[model samples]
Target: MWYLNDDLVDSSYHAENENQVINHISVPNIQRSQHRANLECRARNTVLISPVSKTVSIELNLRPLSVSILQRHSQLSTHTQYEITCESWGSHPPPTLLWFLEGQELKGVTTEESRSSNTSVSRLLFTPTPEFDGKRLICRASNPLLPGTAIEDFWQLRVVYSPILSLRLGSSINPNAIKFQDDVYYECVIRANPPAVKLTWYHNGENLKHTPTSGIIMSNQSLALQKVTRASAGIYVCSATNNEGEGRSNPVELKVMYAPTCRNDLSSAEGTPVIIAASRSEDVNITCEMDALPESLRFHWAHTNTVGEAVDLEPEIYTSQGSKSFLFYNLRSEEDFGTLLCWAQNSIGTAERPCIYQIVPAVDISNYKQYPNYGIKHSFSSSPQFPRHG
Candidate 1:
């Protein structure tokens, strides 16, 4: 005779009514699962029932959420600790917040939520190094309602660091073979977080001024020599600087190419007919050099004996970087004693230098009294009588 939720109440759900046809059912809480429940009333006469009377529908909705990162500094110092905070605002079912660096998920995160606004904030602690400069970080918020889908925000990190520079000569000519009139170029390669603002060039510890019209093409990153000479050859240094700090590179040597020149000063002692005093069996090495340029050269050694006779003797000659060196090994004090002349010739021209080998014998001075006129007399009939530094 009575029904609760379209089910016949077996005298338990019966309520006191005047016609004894009313029943009641109590559900403590009606949730989404219990939505659209029907209730009816019927007169029990040979299994007779009435149509369902009432039904209800329940509607559920959640708030919208957004994820964002808090901007603290535009340029952060490298190798320094920083707190990156991400926030998810106003979400129902509590949107999950996560931190990502360049699409990679991060761990060890701490999250807190606002009780009234339903906003969750997550903080990630990080220390950025120089290798991590110019990278991007991200924060994401995902709802449980929408699985596998998330909203993300990103920030490109500009971590500041000192400049690292490497200066190198950009040229096709070999340094040892560089010749006069050959063009040369130099460039500075730099890497930094904020990047180097400027670069400077120096030659032999002196700053090189720009002389564009004078064939010296000097720029911030490049130093070009259109026409190289002996004055243009030196150690070139490059320096780079930024707001963070400055950096210096290893100096590069630029040698101008030309014909060979005798370096008699480095041979033995300095003189016009460069007088080289040496004892018998002493190592006598003569050398000459030009501003190293790429060119083949011929070396010839001629020795003028004490008898005023010139004979071409085989001298040990070593050539390198526009310079040539000759070594005299095991002189006999009498046979190797002579006026030595070295001639160097290239495609450009030829240059000559002279040397007088005074081979003194290692003998007892008291023996000179026993042997009168035992040594050859010093004479320069054709050469200069008075020696001067070359």
Candidate 2:
């Protein structure tokens, strides 16, 4: 008798036991099933009283397809980003997993080893365009146990971005009330997400369809408009949008200005009467009045017909805080007859006043001039010498 793996085989009555020899037992193509099947075999001599049985056990293997996205649905603006990942769960020589985008194999994928497991995962990160919206992406797991068989999952891609509507004119430039035909400039700005903002202009709260001097530009978080116009005035508003959301700017007002135009007339004063004898001293005075904001006054005098001689005056230059006058001492000749000119100038322009003077024959002489005429008094005790021309 002989035993193979705890099973017995016997040959007794029969001359040859080759016909009763047991060879092999097995469960081929094992797979997860509702019930398990046991494998057994027996070998015996032709006339042996009992036959012996040998047994073996087999277990089924299974794997499941996995689902994950490089990320959850995210916002993308023109030239913005989106990504996805495809991975699975399996054992005994990890199964092969494949990635697909919009039902097509992912063109670019980066792979890394699992840190805690014996599995490999792949990633496909990319920026999606407007053309990528409403597309389908699929992930699958492939294994040899089920040849040409695979588990699958899918996701839908979305594209979201904001669009620019209109621009708002700020109140900083135009305050109070704006006048018509006034040259003016204003600024308009708006803020939004998902970039690529476009700005438009308006007049009197109406959309501007004509030539516009300003343009809209996009910054990190805001939009700008420069050098706006009076026609660009009114309740201005700006709107910005993206796949995420939209925003608007508060209203603004504008005003303009022009040059001031005004006119005025000057009034004169009656002249005072005064006389001066030839070869004698005399004093003269003139007055002027002007009209201007933050008032001012000025005085001037000049001979009209004098021949290269200024009337001898004690104080040639006379000055007061708001007025001026002229004086002469010991006049010697009669060439001083012309006119004394007094001019007053202000912001508006210049005005003038004049005085006329005539020279009369000398009569009363000054003490200095009389001294030469008086005869020398006789000496106290001697005869006074007669005055001589020398």
Candidate 3:
């Protein structure tokens, strides 16, 4: 007797000898249950001779596991539904479909069987979020035909979102006050899943023109302000836009700090010289003062004598606090004795004041008569002070 998977196989049972009988059946399919049957023979004489059936198992180790992504979700935008489809190719017994997210199996995905072909497609639908950006999605194909293994393919998601703009002050100017001619920088940083498409700048609600650099039109990121002036102060805003939408930053105030313009309304603008007589051929100090805003004023002196040509005088090597007029220390009768000109300057502008300067002649030494005494004291002085009678 023979059996195939516990079923009787008596058609090929025949007598091979007087006491031995054999059965042969060609296995058309070598399946897993092929070797699980028993082949046994029994003879009936005076008594029955029977043998126990032997168990066998067939191992058909043919692995046909292959999967691929036929079509995937094209809409890679955040807050939108995304869909993906994958198929199992050249697999026997129709491989099962599975889904994985971050190495973990996901449930609720169903496999679709093809009515015309032996193919099976697995589809997964999900709504993407910000956390799902750049996440990997997997489609797995597994079957009992492969025994204990599965094949999988993966896709990385690209989520697109609008740009969120943030404005910052770069290391060029402060918000309080900016100096004239100083460089200023305004940065418009964009935060988004996908990079921004364009950026724009506005001043006082008017769109500013785009600046070009290296053949590329630059808009966002950073803006350079060169040679800033008083007019550069204004309300500035930045806008950034992406495929999803646009974003803008709050307005920032840009104020420019500069010296005030030199004016002619000074109480001391009347060109009058403050004269110090130079006796004994020494130096003399003169004055021409002006009142100006932005008190960090600069002073310049110029003089022309009777013989020497007009020349610029070097300023004294010291700072004059709360006073605008500086002096020319050394003066000679033949060199620096004529009209002197003074100019006051600030960052805004410069103003000149002309004044008449004269050198008072020194008295002859013969006028100083010495008294007849042991110490030889002078009888006359240049500035005489009489004894106080009161």
Ten-residue region with minimum lDDT total, candidate 1? 380-389
Best by lDDT, which number? 1
Q: Score candidate 1 by lDDT.
A: 0.64
Q: Order candidates by TM-score, high to low.
A: 1, 3, 2
Supply candidate 1's per-residue lDDT for 83: 88
For model 2, what is the error of residue 200's alpha carbon versus the real structure, in angstroms, after optimal superposition?
3.6
Worst 10 residues of 3 by lDDT: 371-380
TM per candidate: 0.54, 0.31, 0.37
Per-residue accuracy of model 3 over 138-240 as CA lDDT, tens digit each: 8888777566777788888777777767777786556665667777788887777667778888878988775543121343487777777766678888888
- Kindly list the per-residue Cα lDDT of model 1 for residues 6-25, writing each as its tens digit: 56654444547765556554
Using TM-score as the measure, name the better of candidate 2 and candidate 3. Answer: 3
Count the clashes in each prediction: 9, 12, 1
Candidate 2, 1-390: lDDT as tens digits: 333334444322333465544353333454544113344455455664777655545334445445454555654554555456666654324566667766678677766656365455667777765555667767666666767557777777666544534343334534543343433443544334445454544445665443334443434333334443333344655454555566555555443321111111221123321222333233333232333222344444455435555443223554423323333322334554433334444443444333333233333313223334222111111222222211
Error of 3 at 323 (Å): 30
Specify the highest-TM-score model's number: 1
What's the TM for model 1? 0.54
lDDT values, one for every candidate: 0.64, 0.44, 0.61
| Model 3 lDDT, residue 102, Cα | 65
